[model samples]
Target: MRGADKLVSDSLATAKRIIDPDTPVLARFDSAFYSANVAKAVRAAGVHYSVTLPQNAAVKKAIAHIPAEAWRGINYPQAIYDDETGRWISDAQVAEIDFTAFSSKAQEEQLAGRLVVRRIPELNTTKLAAAQGQLFDTFRYHAFFTTVEQSVLDTVAADKVHRQHAVVEQVFADLKAGPLAHMPSGRFYANAAWLVIAAISHNLLRAAGSVAGGKLVNARTVSLRQKLVNIPARIAHRARKLILHLPTHWKWATAFDRLWHNTLSPPQLATP
Candidate 1:
């Protein structure tokens, strides 16, 4: 754990060195990276951070202390599909309280931040005879710690932004599915070079997808490669001009044409 925290802090320090001081930066991390030291390191690097907090005793206590009236209801127009529960969540209650984390640590080490909590009703179907006719409602709580000021972002907005951290995981999944499936080399440096090339290829494919527009804008790397990069074509010379011929009746013909025109076409000048 200590080694991982040190690596995170070192990486943040390196980022701080290269990034412009004036540029606003925010780091979002999951529960695995949650720690007082990690938060402190983010602060030292001059960046704002939002980290998912584990539901420990202290956090649960703080959550329980929140008043009923403080909870504000929020709705997601497009229901978020939760993988763990296998349920589509459309609504939840959000509230925040000023809380200090890592109180067990020294006063200087403790970090003070807002504990933002979101709760959804726990509709447990199984019932016990002893627990029949429960007087209070049960809810499952999700919480995170953030240093973002209330004026900049309210509880709902903060929660939404924090959830977007999962998008980076999609990129990792794509890489693992494609070029990163195997190391392919015994030497460490050779494998490292391969990794770099894979990253470059991924970025280029993403750019091609964007240029193609329509559905390809957010297409996966593999799909992009199949539809655009690895097309079957023949190069022919006729009348002192080179012509590339693609397969007829291709399903992705329109998308391919859009990509070709956007990439190779000369820019049109504005008429005077």
Candidate 2:
């Protein structure tokens, strides 16, 4: 929390410089980054932010104020399949409240934002029974604090965009499974450099897949390596020409040929 303000501010400032000034930028973070300083930094950078808030007395109190009608059923972009239950689970609700935060701070430092909350009912036997036994239905709440104004974006739209952060998580998951399998060196700077190199390699592989222009465009790094990067080839030279022989009857031969021709041949210009 101490240096988070500076980190977020600097990152956002850099983003502002790199992107079109008129393009609206929104930063999204999970509960670990929930802090007044971070929110202030986001506001100062002229960017909107949506950060998950840890449940506390004030948050619970705010949830209590939301009317029953406010909660609207929303579908997950992709249905979550539960192996244990052998079913596709897709039931959740979302709502928002106009809330002011950091009240304890001086008037100048206090911030006003929306408390956007998503609640999933506890459907397990024990929790369901507990809910039936009590007057209230048991629910697990996931709420975020956002500075995005209602006029610019509504609650549903903001939540939808915030959920896009999961794509970043997928990239991290891919990295850990591939290039980041080992820390490489004991030195801090060496490991840091390795991480940077890993990211660059990952992007280069992704670009290669895109250039291949097929299912490989969305293929994982390991799959791309297996198909395109690691195939065995034998080289022979005769009459000042080199011939490379790949494995016969290869399954990915068409895709490999496409990649080869597309990469080796320059794009043809259209005649006017």
Candidate 3:
């Protein structure tokens, strides 16, 4: 579980089994998972990967080489709030440059990719003044390494796709909020098994929500459990038939009914 490179290889192999051979796969990872071995594993699997690259000396050098005209303006449909700067940023400039990653690694191990960079105007004048001279306008830069071809998706599209990695963080947050709130045992295997069960339960809840449709489709696990699973009802046997009575005027009753019907409703037979 600790070796990210091995995990990436094994995960990609598992994905290949489930996904069609012709279908393209793209893996996204945060800066923590960025490494020469990880990138090599992804490349060997013949799939594209987008990884958040730490702005180190070499990366800064490559970024510096980008021409002024290369930066194109982009505006997010919904403004993103920057926690670091404490500003609502709606627009930024994005550019890409041909770059090589893991240059310190062996020649064969070095991975070739594009460095897609986005820069937002530095709103904090106090810090900006200390970081750079007043002669130039300061901007905070965010960059990522991606093997996705420019023809398939331009810099802006690739940046958008890379940003979607935040969705995975939401999943982790959901897990922590629910079954993963506490480790049941001190043993590593016990914790691993607990994680597996938690994942399965999460998937089941998501599937149930999808079947139910409506707001429940995107509802969090907590909300889904509250609205559907934790219900006050009475079950009784009457005239050889099982009848369930739910509380009157209960909220989310329709959503529950939809889930029930969608799951248990008889399938229609094809006409001869």
Each candidate structure's count of clashing pairs: 0, 0, 0
RMSD of each: 3.9, 3.8, 4.2
TM-scores of all models?
0.78, 0.78, 0.75
Q: Can you tell me which runs of candidate 1 are displaced by over 4 Å?
A: 14-24, 77-79, 121-138, 230-248, 266-272
Ranking by lDDT: 3, 1, 2
What TM-score does structure 1 among the candidates reach? 0.78
Off by over 4 Å in 2: 20-23, 76-91, 102-109, 121-139, 232-249
lDDT of each: 0.87, 0.84, 0.92
Residue ranges of candidate 3 with Cα displaced over 4 Å? 16-25, 75-90, 121-139, 232-250, 264-272
Candidate 1's residue-wise lDDT over 2-70, tens digit each? 665677778887877898878777889988888878877887877888988899999999999999999
lDDT: the better of candidates 1 and 3: 3
Per lDDT, the best of the predicted structures is: 3
Error of 3 at 73 (Å): 2.6
